[model samples]
Target chain A: MNSVAGTGLARAVGRLRGSGRSAIGRWFVIAVPYFWLALFFLVPFLIVLKIAFSNIQLSMPPVEPIVTWAGDKVFQLRLHFSNFTFVFGDDLYRAAFLNSLQVAGISTLFALLIGYPMAYGIARAPGTWRNILFLLVVLPFFTSFLLRVYAWMGLLGRNGPINGVLLKLGIVAEPLQLLQTDFAVYLGMVYSYLPFMVLPLYTAIEKLDLTLLEAAADLGCRPTKAFFKITLPLTKEGVFAGCLLVFIPAVGEYVIPALLGGPDTLMIGRVVWDEFFGNRDWPVASALAIVLLVILAGFVLLLQKVQAREKEAA
Target chain B: MTGRRSFFVLSAMVFGFAFLYLPILSMIVYSFNASRLVTVWDSAHSPTLAWYVELFHNDQVLDAARLSFRIAAVNATGAVILGTLAAFALERYTRFRGRTLFGLLTTAPMVLPEVITGLSLLLLFVALDQAVGWPSGRDATTITIAHMTFSLAYVVVVVQSRLATVDRSLEEAAMDLGARPWKVFFVITLPLIAPAIASGWVLAFILSWDDIVITSFVSGPGSTTLPQLVFSKVRLGVSPDINALATILVLIVSVGVAILGVYMMRRDRRRARDAQAAFAVIP
Candidate 1:
């Protein structure tokens, strides 16, 4: 009777442990990512949303966090639209936004111009040299970005190398006034972002079927015609991908302009910086940030729709 | 295919390489240029080692370099772990309703403009302080957090691609042989994907090392990075010491990539020779 009782107890313990292990396994697969992204990524965005609506008066230390309503009605928090109004109220912010769009758009276009053919060249190069070419394209990115931009300062400044070289070569009797100009800013932007454009384009173009080009050639398409009709159409996905990669980030760029641009190159990013650090206007900065986010989100949605369409067509 | 086409392509390729390398090569060569001005091209200038020596003695630059390395090391390791986990869960788990959205979230940090990411992170820090009174400040800790958030996205992409190509049957075969899922994953999946992990780690490290925008916004006082230091210095006055630093960076990166290339080339040649010998035997 005691042996029978012992066997029963063992069976029960074994079953309990097995269930526990399986439960732990199931929970592990779900809980880890959920809590992590929530705490770090998703929650941070939510916090931004909350603070954007919160009054600065309630945000002080000791952290009681009171809120006010119209006609002295009290609440714990209130959503305010005044911050958005304040951002749009000023011409400076509006100009900054427009300038940012123009710079990012133009620079992205230029980057594509240089990067697309370069990516094609690298993709079509002998297999032995392909990795080296790709590595070269990306090597500049591994260095100090600020320093690289700073290096351009030496190359573009009034007394810098470019001007000095030009003077010696007798191309210009005097400095061409390249520094602090839109041309300099665009140069810096394209130089920094060109790699981004090339990589995606390279990946996309490398996957192209050589037979397609052959097929076009056999169908009486000239070499240039083959490239334009077959190669370019097939590579459109990559082209758009590279453009988005370059354009999205360029839209919010502040550093290139900050380092190379003159007063005329007032980007929204710099405006955001000035609002937060220079002016200590947290609410206004948050509002501008939201505006930027909304714009970016729209762009992203458009990109997604385009990608989905491409995938379907493929 | 045509001679004309080949000529055009080759010339374009040459110009591309030249355009990319000239400024960098000039920076490297001019680092040793004896003249203070970087432009003048005369052998009589007698290349000197003065700037490199000066760079070693510059306390500010040295401190900033040390700090940058330390932060990058920590950020890269943290990102690899978090990113690998997230990628594993997304890839191995059954497809869910919100999988697309979750995938988008993982990549969103990367796609969004750096200015927005950095600014939003700053705002998040302030909100956290007000809400919980913890992380009541921003410092290297905040900087590391910001770096990891973005770097993790990169690691996930690298690992996810590798995972996608993996033969799921291998893991299923292990399970059929009586290994538990966890044991199979640990013993089989991790070992098979080790190369991906290594590549991801290297890529993450490079990203953190080169980061400036996010670091600029979130880094605390006295936490000035190498790039930030160079930025400030250049803004004040262009210095040849910076050129020396740039030259050193280029050399290190070039050497690293060259070694990787050499190893890959040797491996490819061996594999090709083995294939040819096998074909000879078949014939």
Candidate 2:
């Protein structure tokens, strides 16, 4: 009886596997998300590219057509390269782009500086307390990101708590202009994005083998020297990942700058926002977005190449 | 040397946590301040619950919060369904056509800047409206679609990584017991990955709820989300009412996180016990 049942089960399993491996099943599974992304993600990018080459118009859709159907013998194609030319030629756009990179780069550095120590401390802490400490790091991440930025406004405002405390301590005669300045912007960026830096760093540091550090120590290597030689190299990937995560988003950050930055602080993201909503220049906005996209894609491709090289070396 | 190193580690942890949490703690405290001026603390007035009462009564706040919740709920559900399908395709079928493109689509949005995503989607909607006249205007539907597009990437990342670690033999064995492929998936695979799916749903929900940038671009008049409302108000200056709202959000998120942590702890203990029992049987 047992042998008979086993044979029946084997037959059923074989038939099921045969059916599951069918092309229809595979296609059905793959097509859903693929089609959605094509429709939403890929198609939108194509539209943006098309619009970037079109002239701005004060019409319903707000951009002149790049292509139009004329008589059967003659089809008209009008493409405006001026939008790109204007973005490149104008110093305002150029400065905004450069300022964005500078601010994001500095903010990434600050985030790393503050986040590395915190991640390292958590990784090396007592095992039982590690989870709780990690939770503390991630809790604020799940909270409202806007509210967190708003909290900074309250803290940095002239009559806010930070200023109040400083005034009481005679740190300054008056409330220093902490709000609507570059300092406030950097502080907000670092505060908001520190978790993105810490989580990846902690993942790398936690997986680090202690025996290697011990071996270094036994060889009379100083702790800081061991960290530099052994730990840093091993955690290089995590550092890169964390930096990209913070820097990419920080570059295009709209909220932190708009809320905290003064008019002098010009980021590409704010410029794009102003172009689309304030000026209603869809062509210019699309051009700015495309340029930003190209820069980010270049950064991503470079990181991939570096990663591939590292893999080959290993 | 060890003592000094540990002292440094301890101090770093304290200072880091202080920086992370001090702003939030101040916001929560100021919510109850009686003074209308948020930055000032008048000793004569002291703490009060007036803002909380007013927050509950503010029709604009209530309506915006409702719209935000509805959109987030719909987007979270839609994203999970779409994301799970993508995860299964990437995890289970490796040699499909256009696999590389699918993989790129799955992950690209994870790092794509929100400004670009929002702008592109808004443009897409506008173009679609012009060509097809389907979605005539930006509204809750458009906002939900935009949220799902980006949030789907996060859900896929989470679920796909979990699927990578899931054992395959269980499904094979279920099929061996005369279960069909779909039956095996529903009975064995889904249950095994249910935790990951639940966390993905929660993440999608929070992400959708917290969205302001994308929603701002996609949302039309009368479809304002809570974050947009709060942001517009916050731009003027910090209000005690917003502080009240922030405090409530912090409370709700804390409770949700606490529950998830407890569930995870229990699950870990159960797995440990099961492993021990299996080892005993082997012995």
Candidate 3:
């Protein structure tokens, strides 16, 4: 009876899989989001690219339209590469971009150093405890992002708990310059993005085969050695994924640097925000954004290629 | 098994959690301080709920909260419908023309910097309004749409993962038994993936609610979301009432997440039992 039922299930699945109507279903699933995104997500980049070239004018929208319908059959196209030149030429823009890259890279390193063991611990924990631990990791994520950053302000303030502890413990006589510094910015970045690092690593570590480690152990390999050989290579993708997750957001992180860092700390996200709102340089801001997108898109495509290669090798 | 939980790893877990929760716990503690200044503690009238009362009475906060809630709700619903469709396409229909572009669209938002997305989207809206007289202004309508675009990517991530794990044989079996593709999806696939969809909804809602960057660009005057309002207020310095607001938000989220977690675990166990029973009858 069981054999017959299994055959029936297989036959049913096969027939449905081959059905022509399923093709319509497939298209229905694909077309809706495809159209929605093509209009909303993809087309916006085209507009950004267009606006990046057009001259900024004191109009209501703050930029002249790129394509103007000059008298019949003569549509004038204005392409000013000055915005790109200005973004590239400005020392401030270059500094902010490089600083952002540096800050994000270092923060990604810190998060990985902190997140990997926590993820491994949680992934290896006993069943019920694992879920509870996972929930605990995710709990803060459900709360207000701004408030958590605000919390850091309180904690790192001269009059806050950290200072109080330092003074009471006789560690220092005066309050440290904790807030409005690069240290505070990095700390906030690591804290905000640690969960993003941990989650992917946890998923990867959880799927790791234990028997391989056991086999290595039986062959008289040290635990650390076995881990280095069997585990590290296997979870490299997760680490890379986690690093990307942290790095991308951290590079463009505005709230952390704005709330936590002082005047000297420069980030490109802040630069873009200032140019668009403060300076009212729409074209330059659009140009900055376009460059940022190109760089990020390059990284993403590179990751995709590497992952595809890994899959093929596997 | 014994080697799995090393002293180093266990300590790391403890330390990691401490780093995560200490900021929040301090925030909650400071919210109740009697002093007007958030950083200072007044020993005489400590642990007052004065700020909570102030939060309730603040008209700006109340209005902004209402706006954020409205936008988040609308965004969540729109994102789920679009996200589910996208997830079904990516997971079930693996091979198709433009599949690469479709996948890129679905995932790119997750990694795209908000400033770029916001700037580009604002430009798109401006050009669209200029070309066609529809969506004549940037307001809650535009903010909600912007939120949906980003938040749907998250919804897709969640729902697509769930879809990948779902037992496809059940869906195919129903289709083979003469149920229409749409009907099979509605009746069978939907139930199986409902938890993911629900979580996706909640995630989308929170992301939209918590967003400041995108909303700052897209939202016009008088359409201030709670985060934007709070951001503008707190950009200068900290305040006691914002702490009160934070504490309240954390409490609400904790309760909601706890309930969802427990419910999902129970459902999973019950489903496991049902599967066992069904297989027993088959044998």
Candidate 1 residue-wise lDDT, B187-212, digit = tens: 99999888998988888888888887
TM-score of chain B of 1: 0.95
Task: Return whichever of 2 and 3 wins on TM-score.
Answer: 2
**True-structure lDDT of candidate 1:** 0.80
Window of ten residues with lowest summed lDDT in model 3 chain A: A16-25
Residue B274 of candidate 2: its Cα lDDT? Answer: 99
Docking class of 3: medium
Native RMSD of candidate 3 (Å)? 5.7
* Model 3: DockQ score: 0.59
lDDT of 3 by residue, B29-148 (tens): 999999977888898998899999999999999999999999999999999999999999999887999999999999989899999889888988988898897578889999998999
**CAPRI quality of model 2:** medium
Could you give the interface RMSD of each candidate, to one decimal?
Answer: 2.4, 1.1, 2.5
Clash count for each candidate, listed in order shown: 0, 0, 1
- Please give, for residues B208-280, the per-residue lDDT of candidate 2 as tens digits: 9999988999999969999999999999988999999999999999888777677666777788899999999
Q: What DockQ does every candidate get? A: 0.52, 0.75, 0.59
**TM of each candidate vs. truth:** 0.91, 0.95, 0.91
Q: What is the Cα-based lDDT of residue B15 in candidate 1? A: 75
